[model samples]
Target: MTAETHAVRRGSARSHTVPTATGGGKRRDIQGLRALAVGLVVVFHLLPSLVPGGYIGVDVFFVISGFLITAHLVRELESTGRVRITEFWARRVRRLLPASLLVLAVCVVLTFTVMPAITRPQNFTEIAFASGYVLNWNLAASAVDYLNATNPESLVQHYWSLSVEEQFYLVWPILLTVAVFIAARSRMRAPSTRPLSASVTTRRGVLAALLLVFILSLAFSIYETARSQPSAYFITTTRAWEFALGGLVALVPGLRLSEALRAALSWIALGAIVACAFLFGPGTAFPGSIALIPVIATAILILVGDSRAAFSPQRLAHVAPVQSVGDLSYSIYLWHWPLIVVVAANVSAWPSWVRIPLILVVTYVLAVVTERFVERPFRKPRGAFRRRSVTFGTMAASIGVIVTVTVLATVGIQNAVDQRQDDLQEQLSGGGSSSSECIGAQAVYNDCADPFAYTDLVDPAFAQEDGPWAWFDSELAATACSSATVGSWVERSCAFDGASDDDPQVLLIGDSHADHIASPLQRIAEDRGWALRVETRQACNPFRVAAESDDENAARCASWGADVIAQTVADPDIDVVIVSTRGDSGVWEANAATAFRDLEAAGKSVVVVSDTPNVDGRQVSNGDLITGPACVLAAGSVDDACSWDDERRDTWVEDTAAAEGVPVLDLRSLVCPDGVCHAIVGGLIAFSDENHLSGSYALSLAGWFDRELTPIIDGASARG
Candidate 1:
C-alpha cells in the first residue's frame, strides 16, 4: 500500500468537516496534507534510508478518507434524512477507477513483455487480484503462507491500500444508514425536543458506533500484529481503527479549542507525522500500536486545520509547495511505486543520488499529465459516464481490460511452459542413454553424454512450484500427522507415501537442504516400506550447542534444533537419523561433530548428507542481472547454460560427520559431476532458487538415493 490521499472534502457551510479557505480562496489545506503524505511515500520508495517510517503516509490517507466520507454522510443524514449511497459509489468510481486502471494496464504491458518470462504467470495472478481491488487480501494470504512468504514484490504491490479504502467506501455509508435507522426507531418511542432531533440522535449514534470501531479495531490490530505481523500489516481489520479515528474527529468537529491551541496542535501533529516517517522502518511492527503515531497525528492536523478561524495566520498546509503536491497526489502515488520498482531492479548500476532524482522527475511529469488528462476527464460527469449505469459500466470495463490482458499474457506463458516440457520429453527419448536414467542427476551416474547439457530447462515457475514445502505445511498445519513446524501451530504427517507401524522408522531432519530432498525421499521411503518422518526449518542448522547468534531467526533455529535433537536420540523406535545441514567452519563444525557423536552413542544409525553447492549468489556481470532461472531462460538449452563453477560448500556436512563416526553420503559428484554444475541437468531443473533442489529433480534421483540409504535403513530395521 502507498499514498492514497483523497482530494479535499467539500462540505456544507455549517458542516463539521468544512474545508477552511484562506483569505477568500479555495481551501488547499487537505491538498497540502495529501502532498506531504505522497511525498513521504515516494521518498521512502526511492531512498528509504532518508525516511524509514514513511510508509505511514498510507495511514495519513486512511484518516483523511474516514474524516471526509463520514462528514459527507453525516451531513446528508442531517439535511436530507438519508445518504445517497448510489451517488457516493458512482462518485468513488469516477475518482478512483480511471487512474488506478491506467497504472494496471501499464503493469500488464510490463509483466508480459519487459519483465522476466519465468515469473510472468505469478505476476499476472497478482495483477488480476489488483484489478479486482482485493490485492490486499491476496497479499495477506501470501504473507501467512510460509510457502509464499519469499515471493518477489509485484508492480501493483502498493494497490493494497487502495483496496482497503475501496472496501471502507463500500461499507461505511451502509453503516451510517444503520445509524439513521437506529435514530428513527429510538425517536418513535421517545418524543423529540426540537426539529431534526432525529438527525442529532443519528449523529450521536454514528459517533458511538465509530468510537466502538476505533477501540475494537485498535485492540485487534495490537493482538494480530504480535501474532503475525506480516499478515496483519496488509489485512483491513488491523487498519479499521485509523479510519475510525478520523470518523470520530468528524463527529466532534465543534470541540472549540483556542486559536492558539489549534495552531500549536496542527504544527505538533505535522511534526509527529514527520517523526514517524524518519523513525519507523521495515523492522518496526506496524498497523498496531506503532501506527497510532501517524494516524492520530494526521487526524489532529486535519481537525486543527478545519477549525482554524479566518484571521488565523496561514497554516503550514496552506503553503504553495504542499498545495501543489497535494493537487496531484493521487496520480503521483499511482505512478511512483511502479517506476521505483522497475528502475531499481533494472538500473541498479546508477548511484542512488542519480536514480532517485531521475525517478522523481519522471514520476512528477507523468503525474502532471495524468492529473490533467486522465483524472480530470473522468471527474466530470459527461457522455457515457453521465448515466449511473454507464458509471458502473466504466468500472466493469476498466477491470475487463486488466482481465483480458492478464488472460492473454498467461496463455502465452503457459504455451512456453508446455513447449519446454515437450522439448525435454523429446530429448530424453532421442538419446541412447539408459531410458530409466535420462531424468535428473541419475543421468550422470548412468554415463549419459553431456549429462549437464539440455535443450530446454524446467520452467522457473515449475521449479519454484517443485519445492516440498506444501507437504511440510500439510504436516505442520494438517491433522494427519505430528511433524515439526515453524511455530508448532499444527501436527501433520511428513510422509510422502503412506506408512504404518510395521515399516522401518526413518527420520530425515535438517534445515532446508533436507527439505529439498524430502519429497523425492518420501517416495523412496514408501517404496522401501519405511516410515519417513521429515522435518526441516528454513535456516536452522542441525547442531547440539546451537552456535551463538544475535539474529532472532537464529535463536528460533537454536530452540528448534535442540528439540529435534532431543526427540531423535530419545526415540528408540527411530531406526536411523539422516542429518543434512549447510555446515560452516569454526563453532559450527564443533557443534555438528558433537551432535553426530551423541546420536551414535545412543545406538541410532547416523548418515550425513553433504551440503549442496553455493547456488544462491547473484550473477551481476557487466550491467545485466540474472537471478533464479533467468540464466537458463536467457541461455536457452546451450551446453553451458545456467552452469556454475563454484564447489566449496559441497562437503562441509560430509567431512564433519565422517570425523564423528557418521557414515557420509556425498552427492557433490552427482550434482557437479565434471567440476561444473548446471541449474538444469538432463532436462531437470535442480535448485529452486539458488538454495534448494526442485522436488522434480530430487524425485528423479530416487534410484541412487535408495541404494545409498538401503544399507543404513536395513541395519536399523534389523536392530529394531
Candidate 2:
C-alpha cells in the first residue's frame, strides 16, 4: 500500500454523527450499513454485471470505518484526557495483522503444493510485499507493464486494496494525535471550569479542514478514475478521503430535531443510499462524482437513522446471520478474491452463474473460521493484545525464514533441472542449434523461466535494439534499445545489408512474434541475399479481415489483415509473402483467400507457416514446474500428452490453408517428431511457454529454415 497524504477527512467524526449525549444507541444503523456494504461487495465479486456499481461498497466501508474509529478516539480523549498512541497502534496491529499473516502463510503453503515452480519466486515477492502492506503500488505498476506476462507470480493480485487500507491506518492515528494535543493546549490556556473534552474549537476547525480535503480529494479521484481507473481504484491516495469523509461526520455535533423530522431525514437518507446502490451497476464511473452520493448518503443515514422506527432494511441488517457475517466481513473480503482467482486459473470453464453460491458458501466458511480462530482471540483488550502481537511478530519472522528457505530450495531445484537439461542437450547437441540463445533475447521468457537466470535478446553491443522494452512507456523502449555508447530512440539502424531490391524474396507478416523473427530472418535474408522485408503490427494477425459485425475490435482486426495483404500483393516486385500467426481461428479465411487469389492472379506466391504445437495441460508455464520441459521432452511419442490445440485455430491452418492453395511450410517435422516433441532442442529449451520458441531457439532453427526455404525461394523465382 502506498502512503496517502492526509487532510481534513482525518478529523474526529463526533459532530458528523449522532451525539454521545443522546443515549439512543444506534448499533442497528451501524449494523445496517455494514450489511449493505458487505452484501454489495459480495454480489459485485460474484456477478459484477448484476450490480455494476457495487464496487462503491468499498467506499461506504471506508467512510464507516473512519467515522467509527475517529468517534472512538474522540470519546477516549474526552474520558482519559491523554491519548495513548502505542496502545492504539497495538490494538490496530492485534486486530488486523494476525489473520493477514495467516493468510499469507496458507497461500505460501498452497502455492508450493499447487503452483508451478516458475512462479514461486514471484509469489514469494508478492507475499513479502503484501505482508508489509505495499501490494497496491506493486499491482498499479503491473497493470500497464510490458514484461512478465508469461510467469506473473502472485496468485493473490486482489490484496492491493488491503495494502492501501493498512498504509492509511499507519499515519492516520499520528495526525489524530496532533489534533488532540492542539485541542488540549488551547483548553489549558482558557479559564474554563469544565475540561474541554469535546470542545467545539477542535471539532469546528477539523470539520472545515475535512470539508476542503473532501472537495479536493473528490476532484483527484474523478481525474484519476478518468485517466487510469485501475490505479485510482487500487491506490490509497484516491481512497483516503472517503474514510476521511466518515471521520468528518463523526467529528461534527448532531443537530437537535423533533422525532418526526429525524425520522423523515432517516428515511430520506436510507432511501437515497439504497437508490444509489440499486440504480447504478458496475459500469458506472466510480470513485469519482458518483461516489459522493453514496458516501454522503451513508453519512446522513448514520446521523439520522438511530432515532427512527425500525425499517425493513435496518431490521434485516440487525438479524443474527447478517450481523455475524458483517462482523466477519473483513476476513470474508480478504479470502474471497484470491479464492476466485486461483479457482478460475485452475478451471477456465467456470460457470459465472454457479459462482455466486460457491462464493457465498466459501466466503462464509472462511470468514467464520477466521473470526473464531483468528479475529476473536485478538480483539480482547486483555493479555490478548500482547500475546497476539508476539504471535504476529513470530509469524512475520517465520515468513522471512520461509522466503529464505524457498529461495535456496528454488536454486537447488533449478540447478538440478538445468543439469538434467544439460545432459539432454549433450545427447541432442549435433541435431540443432541452441534455441535458448536466441529465445533469451526476447524477455518474454520471464513468465516461463526463472527471471534470475533468463537471457535477454537485445545484444549489448547492438545500438538499435538494446534498451528498456516496456510497452506502456516509450522511454523504456529508448532505454532498452540503447547500448554502451549512444542511447537513442530513432535513427540507430543496423541491418544485414545482404537483401537488396533486385533479389526475389518473401515477406514475413504478423504481430510481435513476426517482429521477434526480424533479427533471425534478417540473418537468413543476409545469407541468401534475398529481399525479405517484414510488415508486422503488434497483436495483429496477417490473414484476417473486417467482419460485418457488432464486435468492432474483430472487425478492425479483419480490416487490418486485408490492408496488409493488399499492400503486400500490390508490390509486384516481391516474389512471395510468408504468413505466420499464433493461436486464433481463421475468421478471416474467406476474405484472406479472396485477397490471396487476387495476389496469385497478380503473380505473387503466398507461403503459409502453420501454427506450432503448444504444450498441452493445466500447467501455467513450462518454467513454473521444474520438470515440465523435461516431461515434455521425455514424453516418448504420446499424442495426448504432447500436442496443444484450440478448436478455432484448427479451421485456419488445417482447413483454410489447404483450401487457399497456399504452399504450407510444414515445420512440424522439425519441432515435432513421432507425435511428441521436447520444449528443448539440442542443449537449450526452445520455448518459454508451450509454443513460441525463445529468440535463441528460433535463431538456431535458421540453418534448417535456410535449407528448406532457399529451395522454395529458388524454385518460385525460377518459375517467375
Top lDDT hit: 1
Please list the residue runs of candidate 2 whose C-alpha ends up more than 4 Å from where it truly belongs after superposition. Answer: 1-26, 76-83, 115-122, 146-155, 178-198, 257-284, 341-359, 381-720
Question: Per-prediction TM-score, please?
Answer: 0.81, 0.62
- Per-residue C-alpha lDDT of model 2 across residues 226-253, encoded as one tens digit per residue: 6656456677777778878888877656
Q: How many backbone clashes does candidate 2 have?
A: 44
Model 1 over residues 624-692: C-alpha lDDT tens digits? 434446556555556656766755753556777777778888766677766776777766777666556
Each model's lDDT: 0.73, 0.58
lDDT of predicted model 1: 0.73
Q: After superposition, how far is residue 249 of candidate 1 from its true place, in Å?
A: 1.6
Worst 10 residues of 1 by lDDT: 16-25
Question: Model 1 clash pairs?
Answer: 475-492, 481-492, 481-493
RMSD of each: 5.7, 10.6
Evaluate model 2: give its lDDT. Answer: 0.58
